[model samples]
Target: MLPGNVMEIMASPSSLFSAYASFSGSMMLVRTMVNDIIPRPVQAYLWQAIRRLFKANPPVQEHLTLVVEEYFHGQNEIFDAAEIYLRSKIDANTDRLKISKSSDEGVLVSFAKDETILDTFDGVELKWKFVTVTTRRQRRVSYDEGEESQEQYFELSFDKKHKDKIIGSYVPFVIEKSSELKGKEKVLKMFTFGGYGRSWSSVDLQHPSTFDTLAMEPEQKKAVMNDLDRFLGRREFYKRVGRAWKRGYLLHGPPGTGKSSLVAAMANYLKFNVYDLQLSNIRSDSQLRELLLETGNSSILVIEDIDCSIDLPERSAPTQKDPRSELTLSGLLNFIDGLWSSCGDERIIVFTTNHVEKLDPALLRPGRMDMHIHMSYCMYHSFKLLAANYLGIPDTDDENHCHRRVFTEIKGLLAKTQVTPAEVAEELMKSEDPHVALDGLVKLLKQKKRETPADGKLETVEEIEDQLKEKVKIE
Candidate 1:
């Protein structure tokens, strides 16, 4: 049925090869023309349509997935933010979740492993899945080290079109929202260094101290609060000025002048954790640096009784034949204001001492201790606060306050007598009735006034106690 020339071409090898070559050349030319004429979007659309035509069902969306791991080198910031941000999105539909609690914060809830959470941001729906994979490996370092561990991560998926929005806006929004939530439910922690290992352990700080309950001068309290507010609000300013975002305070006074109480109040006011570092326990500068580095940001490091903690050699001292420990005053100063100080941000350093005069001039400089607060003897204003706190006495200005008459007498004695707020608070705690407590405080003040020397100057309470102890030793 075929034509004579076509049948001859098909049967002959040379003729068939020539025909195949011509056909391939024509197909290549047609493909090149189509590629050059059609836009990539249109080509893709056509390709997808052609593929979908043969399939029973097709995927409805072009999805892009991002993996956020829990720890790479250290704890991952994005993973933490995601964990906090997604807690608000855990609806009743979520099958499982993790719940935790601290002493202060009632409860904290989060996602459990393999759980999925659906969230919408800026009208775009995103799917988040908490993934966990467990595996085993050889522990070459130590036999006690765990050979098996779980790796945790989050898989965030969304349509491919909103990649830029998810990265640029939504991710940042999540971080900001997490920060806000953290601020709202922050539970204060008290960290202390244990012997050896140079690590820190923490406990919930439940000290019932606040700015409202502290017995301090009104002006001093206001100044401290304002300074804290300014420091917190000046993160960008610190960056612009090329300085470490930190503040330092030196609290110097007698033992009973509420230095520790003041520190507690500051922690409660700013919602910052406290790291109480004892220098005597530290063996070397490296250990000190490690301890300080272990402390997190937005924390306070307190060196209490710094005068008695260690005998820091003067900078001018000559090198000895052999030093006992590598810890030096210069190293401490460096940690305070040197290059190491910039390792973290939003930090505060506090040094408390009974004798500021014993400290080196280098340690008392402006950058090292930005603010030096002298916790003086109790005054009438302080006593009023104590009265209000302990005996339920109303404000001094209240006309009907039953303690107003006693307050005037106590005010006169407090001006002449040198008594600490702690001493006064102790007196106020003796009796539940305001009148009886106020009367006892008056008697204590009169007794202290009578003991005052003729020159109207006397040794500090600590010095007098030391003298009495010496006398007892002599006896």
Candidate 2:
């Protein structure tokens, strides 16, 4: 019935395929136009009607879900925190670990999809589900040229009865725990300056010192630990009192009396990084402030030998300007207590000196240093602690007569001699044999006593400084 050319064209495979594709495309265009022309309310009603006609209702769940999107108001902190918390739970519960590369840390672990976990807080039950959504979009020019994207999120569900508590208390608690976990997982960093105008260099801090290992009076150690705990716990109190959330410690002691060890111990206890600020290495007041600004929260800033670190001119003394010295006592004081100090929270500043009396009156003032710790000469109790640590002597029992005798002699010698902990520790390390170590310690104590003046007087700061300079010259 048709012409030969028309029959050939209709029978061609390419022409038939093209006609089918054109029909499909025209139908899609018509559907899109209809959707665009329809009012949103009418379209929604039609969609609901269509769904009701063909789709089954989902089963009701007793708990309501709260979805935390990855990006909210251009910040991902909440999403990140939730991911961390959930990942920890998943790691504990599941066998497989999902690993991803991170810019800050080399690698990070997270939960894989289809993993459901249950978490409890303050006797309330909550469930978290890891969901992965994959969406495909076709290009306008070609259907094959399209993009696929995957979005991940966490679905947290809890009973309606716990809605208020979960929002108010549990969320904040999770954030805090997440922060603490992150800190604990990271390596502790220790920073030190090379010289004036030089930047700080960092190393992995591997200090073995702890409150239990440091040789000090038990009561004093307890007091220091308590004070540190109070400081860590009193952020709200500090804010309420209109004070910077920082604490200053003044450690005054003779050389080799465990001041440095105490600083290390504090860092270990608090899990804080230490920035050993060599005051002499700092060139100017502005540099000092910059260094302080560079430091992060939950860190200890230490200035050792504070009395000798700088030539702080007295307020009444004549001003002799030193071109090299730009860091004045006033500037230093301002860095400690001024507006700059309020930049970070949970910070601690420590100053160590051999001579408390030689320190300026302003430095010794009450409000300047919150706590003044006097690291005294090795006492009997401290010696006992050292013995336990070095020789494995148990403080619990005095059953062994040899150990008892050694303890008694050491106690007597310690009362008479002002032996340093460093000296005692060194003597203890000389021999693995407990008896030999104790005997060597006693001999060293006797030798020190014999060398001392009749009044058993200790060298003053000025005398010590002179001896140090002489020693340096000899070296």
**TM-scores of all predicted structures:** 0.64, 0.59
Off by over 4 Å in 1: 1-177, 321-325, 398-400, 453-475
lDDT of 2 by residue, 1-475 (tens): 9999889988899988888999999999988997899987999999888887887776354787888755343224565577667666764567655675533345666677767878999998898877877666665777594665455667889987789999999889888878887665754668876552224556667778899999987767887898899889989999999989998898887799999999999998998889998877677677777777767678899999999888865555666676235777877887788777788889999999998888887886655788888787787778888888998877754566558877887777776777789999999999989989998998998898678765668654345335333322100
Report model 2's TM-score to 2 decimal places.
Answer: 0.59
lDDT score of model 2? 0.77
Where is model 1 poorest over a 10-residue stretch in terms of lDDT? 466-475
Question: Which segments of model 2 are wrong by more than 4 Å?
Answer: 1-184, 196-198, 315-325, 397-401, 454-475
Give the per-residue Cα lDDT of candidate 2 at 157: 91
Model 2: pairs clashing at backbone N, Cα or C within 3 Å: none
